[model samples]
Target: MFLMMGLMYFVVDLAAILLLSACWQRTRIRGFAIVAASYGAGIVARWTAPLAYRWADSGDGGMGSLAGVVVQTAFFLVAVVAVVGFWDIYRVLKQRPAA
Candidate 1:
């Protein structure tokens, strides 16, 4: 199950990069930037979001309620950014520039 989930995530990441390529073609972006943004930043940040939630409620080593609030906020921001990033990529991919 875990392996399948990981594979799905990889598929999502690649699809994001592939889709972004369409828009970047207009602005003249390097291929590496799309791959880096999609796989490195977008996917990695989305994965790390849950980790922040986990850290917010760890054992004694974890911080108090205030820290919990902060970490949860981080989690929310990361998630929001990830979603927005994907949405932006999707929007860009759908555009049809002049020939």
Candidate 2:
């Protein structure tokens, strides 16, 4: 069940990335590009951190190790960037004149 959920999350993330990329290209919107790139980075980090944790667990005999710390830090930073990108998008929309 967890595996299926993970697969679904990856699919959805990929779809979002593609859609955002298209939006960025079509509209030439910086916020869209920033959000899409941040998401792409976050996806890579999301997939990589687990493997790093597993490797560290095998060697260190626990999750409380450097890998876990790095992963957590990366996740936090990525989340911050994602939020900022979203905020920028909101700002852009709010500033635009409605047609």
TM-scores, one per candidate:
0.44, 0.79
Query: How accurate locally, in lDDT, is each candidate?
Result: 0.61, 0.82
Q: Flag clash pairs in model 1.
A: none
What is the C-alpha lDDT profile of model 1 across 1-94, one tens digit per residue? 9768977987877786676666566655444344446455556655665676677668575555766676567656655655666565556556
Candidate 2 accuracy as TM-score: 0.79
Candidate with best lDDT: 2
Q: How well is each residue in 47-98 modelled by candidate 2, as lDDT tens digits?
A: 8887987788777576557787899899898888878878888888888899
Worst 10 residues of 2 by lDDT: 57-66
Return the clash pairs for model 2, or none. none
Show where candidate 2 strays beyond 4 Å.
61-63
Clashes of 1: 0
